[model samples]
Target: MSAMTGELAMCGASVETLFEESVEPVVELVLGGQSARVALFGATVISWRTGARDRLWMSSLSARDGSAPIRGGVPIAFPQFADQGPLTLHGFARTARWRLADRKANLDGTLVEARFVLARSAIADTQGWVGDFELRYTVRLGVRRLELELQVANLGSAPFDFTACLHTYLLLDDVRNVTLHGLSGLEYFDKVAGRDRDEVNDAIRVEAASHSSGDVLGQRAEGFVDRIYRAGGERSPLTLQHAASGETYSIAQSGFPDTIVFNPWVAGKKGTKGPDFDDDGYNHMICVEPAITREGSGPIRVSPGSTWAGTQTIQVL
Candidate 1:
């Protein structure tokens, strides 16, 4: 939505033309008949409110700018390591420009499919950190379903080793009210335990007791959460099912090794002012992320002239 560009168009019933104008890019989405807004910088679908009658699928913050800004929902970084790589937070892929690859009709033309492709820059000699990789993102919407796919290919001459992930912050009516399915038996790190090891004795229940301690400890234990697991043993289409609305979000990934869950209810995380971040500040959004590393530690090793591919699809049920 760069202002320098021009106007945008509304292709629905209005079939109206509008300027694609905004300081930051903005994209409107109609999925499963849901009204969702995605940002240009993150390519993230932030607020998903179905038919204006249903509650927002995620939360938002009251920005000083007058936008009922969805605070904590959306996909985070890509092509960068977290806590481990020299690259900045979440990596550089989020802010880069992507092109519309294709558009086709479905749902008897009631729905549309748009594909976007991201490739390495033409000036690779200057940009050192970013890998020579191509990412294919496809977004589709129907009257009752929404689907998104991310496919990546390594294009460097040398096999590269790197960690990767799709970080999604999902809005929830209440975090404590929901139970995430499909991750019961897998081993997970109880971030509340810090550097310590603890068994998940509580049967991985939805409202299983939650805790936090100290400033650092409390940030994790109290009202906040971060968890990671290996995806080697799970079924292909992992799911995060919301019981109340009977809405199921399924995530399928290939060529990746891990998944992470994080919810920051405190200030820095809530993007608030102080330390005790109100976990539900914007609303209750949970992140079900798939990655090749946990917190950016173990990177996928690549050999020169070798190409690797990773994919994740989000489909509604």
Candidate 2:
């Protein structure tokens, strides 16, 4: 799968904006057999496919009109994560329209980069997070790999604090057959149980791996999970092994010390309720997010004129 030829090619890939399902502008980045589609509405990556096989899970019930946050793919949670802070839900970055400041298809399509900028203005003022901040989100598409970097630069006179995460919703063949490795003995804050505990084993089942309730900070662990694991000093990639499909995906991150492993299996309970993602849809989606929160790893305190950045990379194995 070579780069698109003729006038359609720039550098080596095709970088273009087209109005697809909504009137909002969406950027399409195609590199060889790999492609990613990002919408300016939230600078969200709605779709990512390699070899024509869908690698991302996007909710069919999600709002496509930019009225609300698209419930799937990768939604950038910034200034706030979840309802933990004063800001609304996942913050304005996921709902505000961003400007595509730069696009480059470099090195004969081996690497493609697109940078999105979110400035402090109505987005921050309306969301009650008023500050002179500049967020530069860069998405790089390469051979069998996708890297996402979020750079936050504080341009305000006073220092501002923010908690952010790449709320990535990954598509899987089956949630039951999924097992995560690398978080063997790390402590995690179980949001469901409202307590903190340690992972006693290497294999993390969708439910309780042990019969003891306190072992996992709960009694008879339910069918879903919404916990944040502290990846303390562990820089190795977290591998998600899909038993059924016999495929594996490696997730690595830097500058983010927390990892959120969530699978709202049959979404119905409280915070897990995703109207866009039905009960059955939960069977095919898992969120392995690299994040920083006020509760777990603490919020990012960016000093005035200082810049903070984090990158999450995904590789298919």
Candidate 3:
């Protein structure tokens, strides 16, 4: 119920009360010309707009009543990524409700930040995850950029291992015209191919199937792509460029050792483009996730009373 507003700068945080009865309150952060919306249902950032354009992609068919996980935007995968563990797919974090701990704007109206918290008790009983844990997620909105940080604290008496990922869906003018850089010279686990492979190209491009008969080796066909690149905890940033509009984005992550690139173009063998996702949703969005996971190596371990943190920053260029 705490809300603040300003005039000239138009900077502040406010909860959208209209949906209070259907879903958790959504906190909207505004600073200057930039704005972002975070739904407390999953502590998910559903929208981030800068330069009058939305940088984050959200599915039109996504659930807004809190009955299920929102299909797009930045979904937090905690305690488990996908079906890697005994828990449900992507764990219960994305469907669990979170609390809005705090929100504030900078005195100068140049930045706004909001924090959300989730405890183990909020998880569903069917998830069966009994770890005493607490998750803190912070979203900061600034000029032409958005920052997302996640911290997981083990509050139990014993050590625990888990996998986490900030599943970010970047909105694009066209996925076929985008090229991603910084994954070259790295090894990755190709989920689609079900094998481990090495990335040889410095710039990866996604091309439509009709562009060529899959002649290019490194070029990704306009089909399903699911690969996890081993980042080795590198602090370098990945660059995504849209050839049509010349718009670019710099993606940087810290404390996350892996990056996942995914797109489910034209419902094929994977059948991932379900009812929650539109038929052409994959054409305009690409998921570039920062994760703390190792395919066969196992999950990250945290000792009792310890905390693990990871952050992802997206800047418009």
Which candidate number maximizes TM-score? 2
Assess the local accuracy of residue 105 in candidate 1 as a C-alpha lDDT between 0 and 100. Answer: 49
Clashes of each: 25, 0, 0
Candidate 1: segments with Cα more than 4 A from true spot: 1-21, 29-32, 35-37, 49-71, 107-111, 122-127, 196-208, 212-220, 232-248, 267-279, 294-297, 301-308
Per-residue accuracy of model 1 over 1-317 as CA lDDT, tens digit each: 33211111233411111235433454555533554454544455445455444323344332212132223444545666455566655665555555555555442435555566767772223235746677667655555445556666677775656666666666666666666666656666656456533324332333323443546554434555666676632545666667677777666666666777666545335543333234444236567776776542367765655555555555565
TM for candidate 2 is 0.90
Greater-lDDT candidate between 1 and 2: 2
Predicted structure 3: lDDT: 0.79
| Tens digits of per-residue lDDT for model 2, 1-317 | 33333333755577777886565688988888999989898899988888667888887778878888988889999889888978788888899889988877775658887889998773835566765789999999988888999999999899888888998998888777888888888888877677888888788767433223332343234566777887632645889899987888888999887888887653332324656675577778888889988777798899999999998899998
lDDT of 3 by residue, 1-317 (tens): 23354332344433332356766678777776788888888898999988999888888888888888888899999889887878878888888889888766776766788889998877766366667899999999878989999998999998888898999999988888999998888888877666788888787765454223442334434466778888734735999999998988999999888888888676421335557887678879999999876593358888899998889999998
- Residue 242 in model 2: lDDT: 90
What is the full ranking by TM-score, best candidate first? Answer: 2, 3, 1
Model 3 vs truth, CA RMSD: 3.8
RMSD of 1: 5.8
Q: Per-residue lDDT for 38 in model 1?
A: 49
List per-prediction Cα lDDT, in the order shown. 0.53, 0.80, 0.79
Where model 2 places Cα greater than 4 Å from the true spot, the runs are: 1-11, 21-23, 122-124, 207-221, 268-272
